[model samples]
Target: MSNYRHHSGYCGIEVRDMHPRIHNFTYVSSCVKYMIFMLNFIFWLFGGLLLGIGMYAFMDKWHSTGWVRLETFYDVILNISLVMVIAGVVVFVVSFAGCLGALRENTCLLKFYSMCLLLFFLLEMAIAIMGFVFPQNMNSFLEDKFTDKIIHSYRDDPDLQNLIDFAQQEFKCCGLSNAGYQDWSKNEYFNCSSPSVEKCGVPYSCCINATDISSGLVNIMCGYGVQEHSVAAAGKRIWTNGCIETVRLWAERHLYTIAGVALSIALIQLFVIYLAKTLEGQIELQKSRWAA
Candidate 1:
Protein backbone atom coordinates (compact mmCIF):
# COMPACT_ATOMS: atom_id res chain seq x y z
CA MET A 1 0.00 0.00 0.00
CA SER A 2 2.84 2.43 0.82
CA ASN A 3 4.56 1.54 -2.52
CA TYR A 4 1.33 2.32 -4.38
CA ARG A 5 1.03 5.68 -2.62
CA HIS A 6 4.70 6.59 -3.46
CA HIS A 7 4.14 5.66 -7.15
CA SER A 8 1.07 7.92 -7.29
CA GLY A 9 3.08 10.81 -5.82
CA TYR A 10 5.82 10.35 -8.42
CA CYS A 11 3.28 10.26 -11.23
CA GLY A 12 1.73 13.48 -9.93
CA ILE A 13 5.17 15.18 -9.87
CA GLU A 14 5.84 14.04 -13.46
CA VAL A 15 2.57 15.47 -14.70
CA ARG A 16 3.23 18.78 -12.96
CA ASP A 17 6.72 19.09 -14.53
CA MET A 18 5.34 18.26 -17.99
CA HIS A 19 2.88 21.20 -17.90
CA PRO A 20 5.60 23.75 -17.08
CA ARG A 21 7.93 22.28 -19.73
CA ILE A 22 5.25 22.57 -22.42
CA HIS A 23 4.38 26.09 -21.28
CA ASN A 24 8.04 27.18 -21.45
CA PHE A 25 8.28 25.83 -25.00
CA THR A 26 5.15 27.75 -25.95
CA TYR A 27 6.70 30.97 -24.61
CA VAL A 28 10.00 30.38 -26.41
CA SER A 29 8.23 29.63 -29.70
CA SER A 30 6.26 32.87 -29.40
CA CYS A 31 9.47 34.82 -28.81
CA VAL A 32 11.16 33.25 -31.85
CA LYS A 33 8.25 34.15 -34.11
CA TYR A 34 8.31 37.74 -32.92
CA MET A 35 12.06 37.98 -33.51
CA ILE A 36 11.74 36.63 -37.04
CA PHE A 37 8.97 39.11 -37.83
CA MET A 38 11.05 42.00 -36.49
CA LEU A 39 14.07 41.01 -38.60
CA ASN A 40 12.02 40.99 -41.80
CA PHE A 41 10.62 44.39 -40.96
CA ILE A 42 14.13 45.80 -40.38
CA PHE A 43 15.42 44.59 -43.75
CA TRP A 44 12.40 46.15 -45.41
CA LEU A 45 13.26 49.42 -43.71
CA PHE A 46 16.87 49.24 -44.95
CA GLY A 47 15.69 48.81 -48.54
CA GLY A 48 13.44 51.83 -48.20
CA LEU A 49 16.35 53.93 -46.90
CA LEU A 50 18.59 52.98 -49.82
CA LEU A 51 15.82 53.76 -52.27
CA GLY A 52 15.32 57.20 -50.73
CA ILE A 53 19.04 58.06 -50.90
CA GLY A 54 19.29 56.98 -54.54
CA MET A 55 16.25 59.08 -55.47
CA TYR A 56 17.63 62.14 -53.68
CA ALA A 57 20.95 61.88 -55.54
CA PHE A 58 19.16 61.38 -58.84
CA MET A 59 16.94 64.43 -58.39
CA ASP A 60 19.25 66.88 -56.68
CA LYS A 61 22.21 67.89 -58.93
CA TRP A 62 21.91 65.49 -61.85
CA HIS A 63 18.49 66.89 -62.73
CA SER A 64 19.92 70.36 -63.35
CA THR A 65 22.36 69.44 -66.12
CA GLY A 66 19.78 68.68 -68.79
CA TRP A 67 21.64 70.71 -71.43
CA VAL A 68 24.47 68.15 -71.46
CA ARG A 69 24.17 64.66 -72.94
CA LEU A 70 25.70 63.26 -69.78
CA GLU A 71 22.92 64.96 -67.88
CA THR A 72 20.48 63.25 -70.20
CA PHE A 73 21.96 59.91 -69.26
CA TYR A 74 21.80 60.88 -65.62
CA ASP A 75 18.11 61.62 -66.16
CA VAL A 76 17.72 58.19 -67.64
CA ILE A 77 19.27 56.75 -64.47
CA LEU A 78 16.54 58.55 -62.54
CA ASN A 79 14.18 55.98 -63.94
CA ILE A 80 16.21 53.29 -62.24
CA SER A 81 15.97 55.15 -58.95
CA LEU A 82 12.23 55.49 -59.44
CA VAL A 83 11.93 51.79 -60.02
CA MET A 84 13.93 51.12 -56.85
CA VAL A 85 11.65 53.38 -54.86
CA ILE A 86 8.59 51.58 -56.16
CA ALA A 87 10.11 48.21 -55.47
CA GLY A 88 11.15 49.23 -51.99
CA VAL A 89 7.66 50.48 -51.21
CA VAL A 90 6.14 47.27 -52.44
CA VAL A 91 8.55 45.16 -50.42
CA PHE A 92 7.94 47.23 -47.30
CA VAL A 93 4.18 46.82 -47.56
CA VAL A 94 4.34 43.12 -48.26
CA SER A 95 6.87 42.51 -45.49
CA PHE A 96 4.75 44.44 -43.01
CA ALA A 97 1.81 42.31 -44.01
CA GLY A 98 3.91 39.20 -43.67
CA CYS A 99 4.97 40.22 -40.18
CA LEU A 100 1.33 40.65 -39.20
CA GLY A 101 0.45 37.31 -40.75
CA ALA A 102 3.32 35.58 -38.95
CA LEU A 103 2.23 37.06 -35.65
CA ARG A 104 -1.29 35.76 -36.20
CA GLU A 105 -0.20 32.41 -37.69
CA ASN A 106 -2.11 33.05 -40.93
CA THR A 107 -0.93 30.66 -43.66
CA CYS A 108 -2.56 32.26 -46.71
CA LEU A 109 -1.19 35.73 -45.98
CA LEU A 110 2.24 34.28 -45.30
CA LYS A 111 2.30 32.56 -48.71
CA PHE A 112 1.27 35.71 -50.54
CA TYR A 113 3.87 37.78 -48.75
CA SER A 114 6.56 35.22 -49.49
CA MET A 115 5.78 35.32 -53.19
CA CYS A 116 5.96 39.09 -53.29
CA LEU A 117 9.24 39.12 -51.38
CA LEU A 118 10.83 36.62 -53.73
CA LEU A 119 9.73 38.55 -56.81
CA PHE A 120 11.09 41.87 -55.56
CA PHE A 121 14.34 40.32 -54.44
CA LEU A 122 14.91 38.97 -57.94
CA LEU A 123 14.08 42.34 -59.43
CA GLU A 124 16.57 44.12 -57.21
CA MET A 125 19.26 41.60 -58.06
CA ALA A 126 18.75 42.28 -61.75
CA ILE A 127 19.06 46.02 -61.23
CA ALA A 128 22.22 45.69 -59.15
CA ILE A 129 23.73 43.43 -61.76
CA MET A 130 23.06 45.96 -64.48
CA GLY A 131 24.61 48.77 -62.46
CA PHE A 132 27.75 46.73 -61.88
CA VAL A 133 28.08 45.65 -65.50
CA PHE A 134 27.71 49.10 -67.08
CA PRO A 135 29.70 51.11 -64.58
CA GLN A 136 32.21 52.35 -67.21
CA ASN A 137 29.50 53.90 -69.35
CA MET A 138 28.03 55.60 -66.31
CA ASN A 139 31.46 56.96 -65.38
CA SER A 140 31.94 58.31 -68.90
CA PHE A 141 28.62 60.12 -68.66
CA LEU A 142 29.74 61.88 -65.46
CA GLU A 143 33.08 62.79 -67.05
CA ASP A 144 31.45 64.34 -70.09
CA LYS A 145 29.23 66.55 -67.93
CA PHE A 146 32.27 67.84 -66.00
CA THR A 147 34.26 68.46 -69.20
CA ASP A 148 31.35 70.46 -70.59
CA LYS A 149 31.44 72.67 -67.50
CA ILE A 150 35.18 73.30 -67.96
CA ILE A 151 34.73 74.21 -71.62
CA HIS A 152 31.91 76.60 -70.76
CA SER A 153 33.89 78.26 -67.97
CA TYR A 154 36.85 78.76 -70.29
CA ARG A 155 34.67 80.45 -72.91
CA ASP A 156 32.88 82.71 -70.42
CA ASP A 157 35.83 84.17 -68.45
CA PRO A 158 37.00 87.51 -70.01
CA ASP A 159 40.04 88.04 -67.75
CA LEU A 160 41.40 84.55 -68.35
CA GLN A 161 44.81 85.79 -69.53
CA ASN A 162 45.44 87.69 -66.31
CA LEU A 163 44.41 84.70 -64.33
CA ILE A 164 46.85 82.47 -66.24
CA ASP A 165 49.73 84.92 -65.65
CA PHE A 166 48.89 85.12 -61.96
CA ALA A 167 48.75 81.34 -61.66
CA GLN A 168 52.08 81.00 -63.50
CA GLN A 169 53.82 83.41 -61.08
CA GLU A 170 52.25 81.43 -58.25
CA PHE A 171 53.90 78.33 -59.76
CA LYS A 172 57.25 80.29 -59.74
CA CYS A 173 58.15 79.76 -63.42
CA CYS A 174 60.19 82.20 -65.62
CA GLY A 175 57.04 83.69 -67.24
CA LEU A 176 57.97 84.88 -70.81
CA SER A 177 61.70 84.86 -69.96
CA ASN A 178 61.67 81.08 -69.63
CA ALA A 179 60.14 80.90 -73.13
CA GLY A 180 63.37 82.64 -74.42
CA TYR A 181 61.60 85.94 -75.28
CA GLN A 182 63.20 89.37 -74.57
CA ASP A 183 59.75 90.98 -74.58
CA TRP A 184 56.67 88.82 -74.09
CA SER A 185 56.15 87.15 -77.48
CA LYS A 186 52.95 88.61 -79.00
CA ASN A 187 51.70 85.32 -80.42
CA GLU A 188 53.53 82.81 -78.19
CA TYR A 189 53.24 84.59 -74.82
CA PHE A 190 49.85 86.20 -75.43
CA ASN A 191 48.27 83.77 -72.96
CA CYS A 192 51.53 83.02 -71.11
CA SER A 193 52.31 80.13 -73.49
CA SER A 194 51.60 79.12 -77.09
CA PRO A 195 48.78 76.70 -77.76
CA SER A 196 50.69 75.19 -80.71
CA VAL A 197 53.83 73.44 -79.43
CA GLU A 198 55.31 73.32 -82.98
CA LYS A 199 55.22 77.14 -83.31
CA CYS A 200 56.93 77.73 -79.91
CA GLY A 201 59.69 75.40 -78.71
CA VAL A 202 59.16 75.13 -74.95
CA PRO A 203 56.53 77.25 -73.19
CA TYR A 204 57.85 79.92 -70.81
CA SER A 205 57.23 79.49 -67.11
CA CYS A 206 55.48 82.53 -65.47
CA CYS A 207 57.80 83.36 -62.58
CA ILE A 208 58.48 87.13 -62.36
CA ASN A 209 60.61 88.92 -59.69
CA ALA A 210 58.93 91.49 -57.43
CA THR A 211 61.74 93.91 -58.54
CA ASP A 212 60.38 93.44 -62.10
CA ILE A 213 57.19 95.32 -61.24
CA SER A 214 55.96 95.55 -64.84
CA SER A 215 55.76 91.77 -65.47
CA GLY A 216 54.25 91.20 -62.00
CA LEU A 217 51.63 93.88 -62.71
CA VAL A 218 50.95 92.38 -66.12
CA ASN A 219 50.31 88.97 -64.60
CA ILE A 220 48.06 90.48 -61.94
CA MET A 221 46.07 92.56 -64.44
CA CYS A 222 45.78 90.18 -67.37
CA GLY A 223 42.47 88.53 -68.29
CA TYR A 224 41.88 84.80 -67.89
CA GLY A 225 43.83 82.81 -70.48
CA VAL A 226 44.19 79.23 -71.81
CA GLN A 227 46.76 78.29 -69.17
CA GLU A 228 44.65 79.45 -66.24
CA HIS A 229 41.43 78.00 -67.61
CA SER A 230 43.14 74.79 -68.67
CA VAL A 231 44.55 74.33 -65.17
CA ALA A 232 41.13 74.95 -63.63
CA ALA A 233 39.51 72.70 -66.21
CA ALA A 234 42.02 69.95 -65.54
CA GLY A 235 41.35 70.17 -61.80
CA LYS A 236 37.59 69.91 -62.41
CA ARG A 237 38.15 67.02 -64.79
CA ILE A 238 40.26 65.17 -62.20
CA TRP A 239 37.58 65.64 -59.54
CA THR A 240 34.82 64.38 -61.78
CA ASN A 241 36.97 61.47 -62.94
CA GLY A 242 37.75 60.54 -59.34
CA CYS A 243 34.09 60.70 -58.34
CA ILE A 244 33.00 58.47 -61.24
CA GLU A 245 35.90 56.10 -60.75
CA THR A 246 35.15 55.72 -57.04
CA VAL A 247 31.52 54.94 -57.79
CA ARG A 248 32.48 52.40 -60.43
CA LEU A 249 34.98 50.79 -58.10
CA TRP A 250 32.43 50.59 -55.30
CA ALA A 251 29.88 48.96 -57.58
CA GLU A 252 32.42 46.46 -58.83
CA ARG A 253 33.90 45.68 -55.42
CA HIS A 254 30.58 45.36 -53.65
CA LEU A 255 28.42 43.70 -56.24
CA TYR A 256 28.50 40.37 -54.43
CA THR A 257 28.20 42.01 -51.04
CA ILE A 258 25.02 43.80 -52.02
CA ALA A 259 23.58 40.70 -53.63
CA GLY A 260 24.46 38.59 -50.63
CA VAL A 261 22.77 40.92 -48.18
CA ALA A 262 19.69 41.04 -50.38
CA LEU A 263 19.55 37.30 -50.73
CA SER A 264 20.14 36.79 -47.02
CA ILE A 265 17.20 38.99 -46.20
CA ALA A 266 15.00 37.03 -48.61
CA LEU A 267 16.11 33.74 -47.12
CA ILE A 268 15.36 34.96 -43.63
CA GLN A 269 11.88 35.93 -44.75
CA LEU A 270 11.41 32.50 -46.27
CA PHE A 271 12.43 30.90 -43.02
CA VAL A 272 9.96 33.06 -41.12
CA ILE A 273 7.22 32.05 -43.54
CA TYR A 274 8.10 28.40 -43.03
CA LEU A 275 8.07 28.78 -39.28
CA ALA A 276 4.72 30.56 -39.39
CA LYS A 277 3.29 27.78 -41.52
CA THR A 278 4.55 25.15 -39.13
CA LEU A 279 3.02 26.97 -36.17
CA GLU A 280 -0.29 27.23 -38.06
CA GLY A 281 -0.27 23.48 -38.65
CA GLN A 282 0.47 22.86 -34.98
CA ILE A 283 -2.34 25.15 -33.89
CA GLU A 284 -4.78 23.26 -36.12
CA LEU A 285 -3.57 19.92 -34.81
CA GLN A 286 -3.99 21.15 -31.25
CA LYS A 287 -7.58 22.21 -32.01
CA SER A 288 -8.41 18.80 -33.50
CA ARG A 289 -6.96 16.97 -30.58
CA TRP A 290 -8.79 19.18 -28.13
CA ALA A 291 -12.05 18.60 -30.00
CA ALA A 292 -11.44 14.82 -29.98
Candidate 2:
Protein backbone atom coordinates (compact mmCIF):
# COMPACT_ATOMS: atom_id res chain seq x y z
CA MET A 1 0.00 0.00 0.00
CA SER A 2 2.89 2.40 0.83
CA ASN A 3 4.65 1.47 -2.45
CA TYR A 4 1.38 1.97 -4.35
CA ARG A 5 0.72 5.28 -2.58
CA HIS A 6 4.27 6.52 -3.33
CA HIS A 7 4.07 5.38 -7.00
CA SER A 8 0.77 7.36 -7.37
CA GLY A 9 0.91 11.14 -7.68
CA TYR A 10 -1.98 11.75 -5.22
CA CYS A 11 -0.48 10.92 -1.79
CA GLY A 12 2.86 12.35 -3.02
CA ILE A 13 1.10 15.70 -3.59
CA GLU A 14 -0.23 16.01 0.01
CA VAL A 15 -1.84 13.71 2.57
CA ARG A 16 -1.07 16.14 5.36
CA ASP A 17 -4.51 17.82 5.22
CA MET A 18 -6.66 14.94 3.92
CA HIS A 19 -9.08 13.14 6.24
CA PRO A 20 -7.37 10.57 8.48
CA ARG A 21 -9.96 7.85 7.92
CA ILE A 22 -10.82 6.99 4.31
CA HIS A 23 -14.51 6.04 3.98
CA ASN A 24 -14.46 4.95 0.34
CA PHE A 25 -11.81 3.35 -1.91
CA THR A 26 -13.39 4.93 -5.02
CA TYR A 27 -13.57 8.71 -5.65
CA VAL A 28 -15.93 10.99 -3.66
CA SER A 29 -18.97 9.37 -2.09
CA SER A 30 -22.13 9.93 -4.16
CA CYS A 31 -23.84 11.89 -1.39
CA VAL A 32 -20.88 14.23 -0.85
CA LYS A 33 -20.47 14.80 -4.58
CA TYR A 34 -24.10 15.75 -5.22
CA MET A 35 -24.57 17.66 -1.96
CA ILE A 36 -21.45 19.82 -2.35
CA PHE A 37 -22.31 20.45 -6.01
CA MET A 38 -25.83 21.52 -5.04
CA LEU A 39 -24.58 23.77 -2.25
CA ASN A 40 -22.02 25.34 -4.58
CA PHE A 41 -24.74 25.92 -7.23
CA ILE A 42 -26.98 27.56 -4.60
CA PHE A 43 -24.07 29.80 -3.56
CA TRP A 44 -23.46 30.59 -7.22
CA LEU A 45 -27.06 31.79 -7.51
CA PHE A 46 -26.78 33.86 -4.33
CA GLY A 47 -23.50 35.41 -5.57
CA GLY A 48 -25.16 36.34 -8.88
CA LEU A 49 -28.03 37.89 -6.96
CA LEU A 50 -25.69 39.97 -4.80
CA LEU A 51 -23.71 41.06 -7.85
CA GLY A 52 -26.91 42.04 -9.71
CA ILE A 53 -28.33 44.08 -6.82
CA GLY A 54 -24.99 45.75 -6.17
CA MET A 55 -24.69 46.85 -9.78
CA TYR A 56 -28.31 47.99 -9.84
CA ALA A 57 -27.88 50.05 -6.67
CA PHE A 58 -24.60 51.50 -7.98
CA MET A 59 -26.26 52.45 -11.25
CA ASP A 60 -29.18 54.01 -9.39
CA LYS A 61 -26.71 56.13 -7.47
CA TRP A 62 -24.95 57.07 -10.69
CA HIS A 63 -28.25 58.18 -12.23
CA SER A 64 -29.02 60.28 -9.14
CA THR A 65 -25.51 61.76 -8.86
CA GLY A 66 -26.47 65.05 -10.58
CA TRP A 67 -29.14 65.62 -7.91
CA VAL A 68 -26.68 65.45 -5.00
CA ARG A 69 -25.65 68.70 -3.28
CA LEU A 70 -21.98 67.87 -3.81
CA GLU A 71 -20.07 67.44 -7.08
CA THR A 72 -18.35 64.35 -5.55
CA PHE A 73 -20.89 62.28 -3.60
CA TYR A 74 -19.22 59.00 -2.69
CA ASP A 75 -20.57 57.81 0.65
CA VAL A 76 -21.77 54.77 2.67
CA ILE A 77 -24.22 53.59 0.03
CA LEU A 78 -21.47 53.54 -2.59
CA ASN A 79 -19.18 51.79 -0.16
CA ILE A 80 -21.82 49.17 0.64
CA SER A 81 -22.47 48.56 -3.06
CA LEU A 82 -18.77 48.04 -3.63
CA VAL A 83 -18.60 45.62 -0.70
CA MET A 84 -21.50 43.65 -2.12
CA VAL A 85 -19.76 43.51 -5.47
CA ILE A 86 -16.50 42.29 -3.94
CA ALA A 87 -18.25 39.75 -1.69
CA GLY A 88 -20.22 38.42 -4.66
CA VAL A 89 -17.06 38.06 -6.72
CA VAL A 90 -15.34 36.15 -3.90
CA VAL A 91 -18.33 33.85 -3.37
CA PHE A 92 -18.41 33.09 -7.08
CA VAL A 93 -14.72 32.25 -7.19
CA VAL A 94 -14.80 29.97 -4.13
CA SER A 95 -18.11 28.32 -4.99
CA PHE A 96 -17.00 27.72 -8.58
CA ALA A 97 -13.97 25.90 -7.22
CA GLY A 98 -16.18 23.75 -5.00
CA CYS A 99 -18.52 22.94 -7.88
CA LEU A 100 -15.75 22.04 -10.30
CA GLY A 101 -13.68 20.26 -7.68
CA ALA A 102 -16.60 18.06 -6.63
CA LEU A 103 -17.58 17.30 -10.23
CA ARG A 104 -14.07 16.43 -11.42
CA GLU A 105 -12.77 14.98 -8.11
CA ASN A 106 -9.77 17.34 -8.03
CA THR A 107 -8.08 17.03 -4.62
CA CYS A 108 -6.12 20.30 -4.73
CA LEU A 109 -9.14 22.40 -5.68
CA LEU A 110 -11.20 20.55 -3.06
CA LYS A 111 -8.64 21.38 -0.34
CA PHE A 112 -8.56 25.01 -1.45
CA TYR A 113 -12.36 25.18 -1.30
CA SER A 114 -12.28 23.49 2.12
CA MET A 115 -9.74 26.02 3.42
CA CYS A 116 -11.93 28.88 2.25
CA LEU A 117 -15.00 27.36 3.90
CA LEU A 118 -13.14 26.71 7.17
CA LEU A 119 -11.91 30.29 7.28
CA PHE A 120 -15.40 31.61 6.60
CA PHE A 121 -16.86 29.35 9.25
CA LEU A 122 -14.35 30.46 11.87
CA LEU A 123 -14.87 34.16 11.10
CA GLU A 124 -18.65 33.82 11.04
CA MET A 125 -18.73 31.89 14.32
CA ALA A 126 -16.50 34.47 15.98
CA ILE A 127 -18.66 37.35 14.76
CA ALA A 128 -21.85 35.63 15.86
CA ILE A 129 -20.49 34.90 19.32
CA MET A 130 -19.18 38.45 19.72
CA GLY A 131 -22.40 39.98 18.46
CA PHE A 132 -24.49 37.83 20.79
CA VAL A 133 -22.36 38.69 23.80
CA PHE A 134 -22.09 42.41 22.99
CA PRO A 135 -25.19 43.47 21.13
CA GLN A 136 -25.16 46.91 22.77
CA ASN A 137 -21.52 47.38 21.94
CA MET A 138 -22.20 46.39 18.34
CA ASN A 139 -25.05 48.87 18.15
CA SER A 140 -22.97 51.63 19.69
CA PHE A 141 -20.11 50.88 17.33
CA LEU A 142 -22.35 51.03 14.26
CA GLU A 143 -24.10 54.17 15.51
CA ASP A 144 -20.84 56.06 15.90
CA LYS A 145 -19.18 54.76 12.73
CA PHE A 146 -22.22 54.36 10.48
CA THR A 147 -25.28 56.33 11.64
CA ASP A 148 -23.23 59.43 12.51
CA LYS A 149 -21.73 59.40 9.04
CA ILE A 150 -25.18 59.06 7.48
CA ILE A 151 -26.63 61.90 9.56
CA HIS A 152 -23.72 64.29 8.99
CA SER A 153 -23.62 63.53 5.27
CA TYR A 154 -27.39 63.41 4.73
CA ARG A 155 -27.66 66.24 2.24
CA ASP A 156 -24.32 65.52 0.62
CA ASP A 157 -25.94 62.68 -1.35
CA PRO A 158 -29.56 62.59 -2.46
CA ASP A 159 -29.78 58.79 -2.22
CA LEU A 160 -28.55 58.87 1.39
CA GLN A 161 -31.04 61.67 2.15
CA ASN A 162 -33.92 59.65 0.71
CA LEU A 163 -32.77 56.50 2.59
CA ILE A 164 -32.58 58.34 5.92
CA ASP A 165 -35.98 59.91 5.34
CA PHE A 166 -37.52 56.54 4.53
CA ALA A 167 -35.95 54.92 7.58
CA GLN A 168 -37.08 57.74 9.88
CA GLN A 169 -40.63 57.61 8.55
CA GLU A 170 -40.95 53.87 8.38
CA PHE A 171 -39.52 53.38 11.86
CA LYS A 172 -41.57 56.27 13.30
CA CYS A 173 -38.30 57.84 14.44
CA CYS A 174 -36.29 61.02 14.04
CA GLY A 175 -32.65 61.72 14.89
CA LEU A 176 -29.94 59.19 15.78
CA SER A 177 -30.42 59.43 19.55
CA ASN A 178 -33.40 58.95 21.88
CA ALA A 179 -32.88 62.61 22.74
CA GLY A 180 -34.68 63.23 19.44
CA TYR A 181 -34.49 66.56 17.65
CA GLN A 182 -31.40 67.62 19.60
CA ASP A 183 -29.37 65.41 17.24
CA TRP A 184 -30.78 67.12 14.18
CA SER A 185 -28.89 70.20 15.34
CA LYS A 186 -25.98 68.56 13.55
CA ASN A 187 -27.61 69.62 10.29
CA GLU A 188 -26.77 73.27 9.64
CA TYR A 189 -30.24 73.96 8.24
CA PHE A 190 -32.08 72.34 11.15
CA ASN A 191 -29.90 73.75 13.90
CA CYS A 192 -32.15 75.13 16.64
CA SER A 193 -30.29 78.46 16.84
CA SER A 194 -29.19 78.71 13.20
CA PRO A 195 -29.53 82.09 11.46
CA SER A 196 -30.69 80.32 8.28
CA VAL A 197 -34.36 80.48 7.30
CA GLU A 198 -34.61 76.66 7.71
CA LYS A 199 -33.68 76.76 11.39
CA CYS A 200 -35.73 74.76 13.96
CA GLY A 201 -37.32 72.52 11.30
CA VAL A 202 -36.77 68.78 11.00
CA PRO A 203 -37.07 66.93 7.70
CA TYR A 204 -40.58 66.25 6.39
CA SER A 205 -40.02 62.58 7.31
CA CYS A 206 -40.45 63.22 11.07
CA CYS A 207 -44.06 64.43 10.72
CA ILE A 208 -47.01 62.12 11.37
CA ASN A 209 -49.31 61.47 8.35
CA ALA A 210 -47.05 63.93 6.48
CA THR A 211 -49.86 65.87 4.80
CA ASP A 212 -50.95 69.51 4.88
CA ILE A 213 -54.23 70.11 6.72
CA SER A 214 -55.48 72.52 4.07
CA SER A 215 -53.86 71.57 0.72
CA GLY A 216 -53.62 67.83 1.59
CA LEU A 217 -51.06 67.42 -1.24
CA VAL A 218 -47.86 66.10 0.42
CA ASN A 219 -46.82 68.75 2.94
CA ILE A 220 -43.17 69.55 2.36
CA MET A 221 -43.24 71.81 5.44
CA CYS A 222 -45.11 69.41 7.72
CA GLY A 223 -42.08 69.09 9.98
CA TYR A 224 -41.41 72.85 10.00
CA GLY A 225 -40.82 74.29 13.51
CA VAL A 226 -41.43 70.82 14.99
CA GLN A 227 -38.05 70.79 16.77
CA GLU A 228 -38.99 73.93 18.74
CA HIS A 229 -41.99 72.22 20.41
CA SER A 230 -41.88 70.49 23.81
CA VAL A 231 -41.46 66.71 23.72
CA ALA A 232 -45.11 66.05 24.67
CA ALA A 233 -46.40 68.47 22.03
CA ALA A 234 -43.94 67.17 19.42
CA GLY A 235 -44.97 63.55 20.09
CA LYS A 236 -48.49 64.45 18.95
CA ARG A 237 -47.17 66.12 15.76
CA ILE A 238 -44.39 63.69 14.84
CA TRP A 239 -42.31 60.81 16.07
CA THR A 240 -40.47 62.23 19.03
CA ASN A 241 -38.26 59.16 19.64
CA GLY A 242 -35.01 58.59 17.81
CA CYS A 243 -34.10 55.96 15.17
CA ILE A 244 -31.58 54.04 17.31
CA GLU A 245 -34.20 52.75 19.74
CA THR A 246 -36.63 51.90 16.98
CA VAL A 247 -33.88 50.10 15.06
CA ARG A 248 -32.88 48.21 18.19
CA LEU A 249 -36.53 47.30 18.77
CA TRP A 250 -36.89 46.16 15.17
CA ALA A 251 -33.76 44.03 15.47
CA GLU A 252 -35.02 42.51 18.70
CA ARG A 253 -38.28 41.67 16.97
CA HIS A 254 -36.41 39.90 14.18
CA LEU A 255 -33.69 38.38 16.34
CA TYR A 256 -34.77 34.83 15.59
CA THR A 257 -34.50 35.31 11.83
CA ILE A 258 -31.11 36.95 12.17
CA ALA A 259 -29.75 34.21 14.41
CA GLY A 260 -31.09 31.52 12.14
CA VAL A 261 -29.37 33.04 9.11
CA ALA A 262 -26.06 33.36 10.94
CA LEU A 263 -26.19 29.80 12.22
CA SER A 264 -27.27 28.46 8.85
CA ILE A 265 -24.34 30.07 7.03
CA ALA A 266 -21.84 28.80 9.59
CA LEU A 267 -23.25 25.28 9.46
CA ILE A 268 -23.14 25.30 5.67
CA GLN A 269 -19.48 26.28 5.77
CA LEU A 270 -18.70 23.49 8.22
CA PHE A 271 -20.52 20.97 6.06
CA VAL A 272 -18.57 22.05 2.97
CA ILE A 273 -15.32 21.75 4.87
CA TYR A 274 -16.17 18.19 5.93
CA LEU A 275 -17.16 17.15 2.43
CA ALA A 276 -13.96 18.59 0.96
CA LYS A 277 -11.84 16.70 3.49
CA THR A 278 -13.62 13.43 2.78
CA LEU A 279 -13.30 13.96 -0.97
CA GLU A 280 -9.59 14.63 -0.60
CA GLY A 281 -9.14 11.34 1.29
CA GLN A 282 -11.09 9.46 -1.37
CA ILE A 283 -9.00 10.99 -4.16
CA GLU A 284 -5.78 9.89 -2.46
CA LEU A 285 -7.17 6.37 -1.93
CA GLN A 286 -8.32 6.13 -5.54
CA LYS A 287 -4.89 7.06 -6.82
CA SER A 288 -3.29 4.38 -4.62
CA ARG A 289 -5.84 1.81 -5.84
CA TRP A 290 -5.16 2.77 -9.47
CA ALA A 291 -1.39 2.36 -8.95
CA ALA A 292 -1.85 -1.03 -7.25
Best by lDDT: 2
Stretches > 4 Å off in candidate 1: 1-32, 40-88, 128-233, 236-238, 242-245, 253-270, 273-292
lDDT string for model 1 (234-279, tens) is 2331111222354455556777887688778777756765665665
Worst 10 residues of 1 by lDDT: 174-183
The lDDT for every candidate, in the order shown, is 0.48, 0.76
State the TM-score for model 1.
Answer: 0.39
Model 1 lDDT vs. the true structure? 0.48
User: Would you list the clashing residue pairs of candidate 2?
Assistant: none
Name the runs in model 2 displaced over 4 angstroms: 1-25, 66-78, 192-198, 211-218, 253-261
Cα TM-score per model:
0.39, 0.73
